[model samples]
Target: MASAVFVLAPLPLGSVDLAWVCIWTAVLSASLLTARVDHGCKADLWFMVPILAAIAAIAVIVWIQVAPNILANLQDPAWGNARDLAGIDVPGRISLTRSSPLLSFGYYLVFVLGLSRAYLLGIDGWQAHKLLKLVAYASVCYALYGILSQLLLPDTLLWRQKEFYLEYATGTFVNRNTAATFWGSGGLILLIMMVRSILHKSDDADSARVRFLDRPATQAVGCGICLVAVGMTGSRAGILITVLSMVCAIVLYLAPLNRGGWLLWTSVRNSLVAGIIVLALVGSLAMGRISQIGLVDGQRYEVYKTVLDMIRGHTVLGFGAGNFDAAFPPFRPASLGSQGIWDRVHSTPLELVLDLGLPAATAVFAVAVFFFASLITAALRRKRDRHIPVIAAGAFFLGSLHSFVDFSLQIPGFGLLFACVLGCGLAQSISTSTRGLARRAPDWDSPILR
Candidate 1:
């Protein structure tokens, strides 16, 4: 879990990319070792089988169609490497070694499943609690960094080239919004943990590690700190999504489904109270930003509108994946010529449509639907803490909602984090498998058992 947190935690420079490679290498090596140590363990086999099959199928399909162009991109100059395939220019062809169909599918496949594994281990395995702690610690560190960064060096310093992005607070992230997104998601999860701990006071020893959550004042304080961080980032989309996620969590956990019970009314009343509290805090801390967010008649709103136009133009296949960086200009207003150098679509669904076409988009949506349904069903069945799934569900919804305006999830780090949380929720929805540490252990920590 420490290793996982280190791998995913935000870094100040391009070092995060290096961390990604290192973490993946460690994960793969550990998996191999664990299989040898726990010979009878079928955890990896069961979890990986479907993921491998999907990768295999996608690889075959992409190879036949996209191999040549991808290979060409590899050899081409960095600036000119990007091309319009199926209307989208695959992103990062020049910077990355492989761009062919097979590699692309393989990359995304691993990316998705790696997270699924994390989620599975975190939610169902004994490591779930540990993983949550790791996440919280990492988040608190990140929040502290943001606050300090603002205080010590409010302006970008000469040594800090990366600190120029003032629109959002990056903390340890490459982008401010990305940092806030992480913090926001972590905030929601923390809220759930704190609330759950409160509801289970007698299980004090077991919940001691997460005991800080039991205090209402502490929860409120934590929420306040996180909300302020969210506001400082100037991420209206993120702020909205975070609030929505909180609401959804409440609805999923507190709302009653039974025929006759005060649960429904209680849930409603609680929701109203939570909503008021969140609103009051956010309104106080972020009143200025909130006003600006509501009045979105400037460049940002125009960018969103233009993206809508582009999506309409290429509705069926959309621009090819990564093509928006090159394809955005033709759709932009002439006055913003130099301003719109074409970097991103600023929208995830639109990006998807442009990347693989309508069919691919549909396929992605289908997968999301399946995961969501399964999560909701599982959460509802948990006669105990319904809020757990509610929190997960809210984060999922919020992240998806956020993708509409910002491409935060497109960043590999952010994307991986999103996948990890979603996968964890999905895994939780399924069988609640519990394993003795001896029987089920990741490879890296296997030696510790001895």
Candidate 2:
């Protein structure tokens, strides 16, 4: 039930609040139902203490008012009397500069708790597999909906007036790129499942024929639909990144079959044939839109420069969490030449620096890199459940790359999904033993066994 909500929550404007409620409910329900709660990591408290402390520090910075003298020192000299002239209602108290600091904290807390829950759930392989299946099928449903909507109701989005990207497949999302990334992650899972089916062949030919319309074929069809939807979104980066992820999955799937040269060749040949068919279908639907990859938006570069300037001024402490829009107007570059509101900088890393300062942002980045490295190591060394780490790695790679050029990671749906995958990867890394260790295991009578 929670998995269903998580998968479908992205449809309603990315479901910022809805996702939080669903996750909170799921966590509480799981806690009540289970007798033994598996935290999944022995070092969980050691790792979590600092993270929680950081969150506490941020909360203090956001909710409490700094001394006037200290606040004055932090302000730019150019703002001169603005800080003094902006009269305060209370003598020693002033809210954060952010437009909605409490809201920002709420979102951050939700993500933290959600990741924790996902990690615990991922410790059970069966549960993780079920979650993966849910994600894939949900994506397929959304993909089909997006495709049909584009074909049948070009001017409407989810049966409402289309605000933007009229011709693109937005898939219940306001932005086509978000839809593409979400479905792209889903497509990767389906691709992995398809590859697994190919690698693990059934012995009984009669039974295999009887179950021809089984899970594998269904996954293949879902993957095709997702690819077509991604291509139709007209997002150049989305198509390229998704294709790269697919290629990575294919290489990983084929690399292990190299012991048998003929078998490896056969697998490659079959994969190529399937790839060609899927690509042809995607191409027909996209109508050569992938060629637009070369086009670059200069406005984004200007925005990035402005964000850098903001970061430099607040090198130690940021303006405030969720304060980008409020803090941006003063730093808006003249070169931008736009009167429209600049809400997001289109770069999550730069935005993070602006929100949490360099130190905090660095801490976050380091943790992420550590988990990614651990997952990569586990994927290469572990004999069983290797696909789990591979899928997680692929998801992380897609989100990380997309974040550089776009704000897909900032969207709650994509952010939550990425966190879930990361948690699963972390769980897999801790639970699986290295091949060498497994080989060295002794028999029941051995001293080591005791």
Candidate 3:
């Protein structure tokens, strides 16, 4: 039930829906605790502790700045010019963020706790697979809605006012890039399922024969639909990253197959050909939008430079979390032409540095790198239940790569989904008891593993 709500909570594009989802998630987490489920904390708690501590430190920094005496005592001369440029008085109680820092902290807490609960759920193999299937199905449904809405009602968003990007498939998301990210994730999941189906070998004589209409074919159709929806989003980064993720999935699938070198090469060639064909079809419909990737968008580049300046001013402690918009106006470059509000720097990494400063951001990044590395190592080494890790790795790659150029990670829906995948991957990597449980339980390996 919690999984379903998590999958659908992004549709409304409001905070209330996410808050309700968080409440239900907390309830579900409490129930799991009562059941005494292994939360996979033994493997990741060390890393998580530092991240939590960093958040706490940032909170402290925000709180202290609110007190005039503390702010004056800690004032730096280097910040004087930036303060004058921003037109804000020194030692004032106002936080750097446009919104309340306490609210941002609450949201971050919910996200972290939600991720921990997902890890617990994923320690159980059956539960993990069920959650993956549910998320995949929900993503596909959203993709269909996006495609249909764009074709039938291009002028409206969920039957409401269409303020912008009417021609693109934004789905239930406010941004086309975010919608593409969601669809791309769904495509990766379907791709993994399709590969697993193809590689499946059944011992039963009746199941040994391959049929024209099979699970793999069905998954392939779904994957194609998702890819098409991603292309329709008309986002260059989205299409490229999604394609790269698919290629990664194909490579992961081909790696462990016990096939001859010639056969493997042929399979790779065929997969590449299929990918090209899909791209060509979608590209035609996109009408040269993919070609725009070669051009540089000066506005985002300018914003990136201004954000770097902001980071330079606050080398130790950042302005504040969720403070990008409020902290940006003073550093806004005249070259940006003063036409639009640069709320986000459009790069998650830079924004993290801006919000948390270098030290805290570095700590957070190190933890992420360690987590992903652990999962990838497990995926490569594990003899059984390898698909879960592979899928998680692919999903992580999609989100991480997109973060370098877009703010997909800042969006609650994408962030929650990414965290869920990360938790599941970590759980699969480190949960010894779950493996033991699987062995003691009934041998319910699907036909794919038989």
The model with the greatest lDDT is: 3
Error of 2 at 446 (Å): 28
Residue 203 C-alpha lDDT in model 2: 40
Off by over 4 Å in 3: 14-35, 38-41, 44-68, 71-94, 97-99, 202-214, 258-270, 284-287, 290-295, 431-435, 439-450
lDDT per residue as tens, model 2, 208-327 = 453432367888988888998998897766776787777666655455545577877776676667656655656443435534433466788889988988788787667667778877
What would you estimate as the lDDT of candidate 2?
0.67
Give the per-residue lDDT of model 1 (tens digit) for 3-116. 463345345332235446455545644653442223223544444455555455445444433333444423224324345434446543322223433333433654555564
Relative to the true structure, how large is the alpha-carbon lDDT of every model?
0.56, 0.67, 0.70
- Cα deviation at 236, candidate 1, in Å, is 1.2
The global Cα lDDT (0 to 1) of model 3 is 0.70
Runs of candidate 1 exceeding 4 Å displacement: 5-7, 12-65, 69-110, 123-125, 156-159, 201-221, 256-262, 283-287, 293-319, 335-337, 384-388, 431-450
Over 155-263, each residue of candidate 3 has an lDDT whose tens digit, in order, gives 8888588777887888888888888888899889878877777766645456755554337877888888888889889887788778777777677656656347887
The residue pairs in collision within model 3 are none
Better of 1 and 3 by lDDT: 3
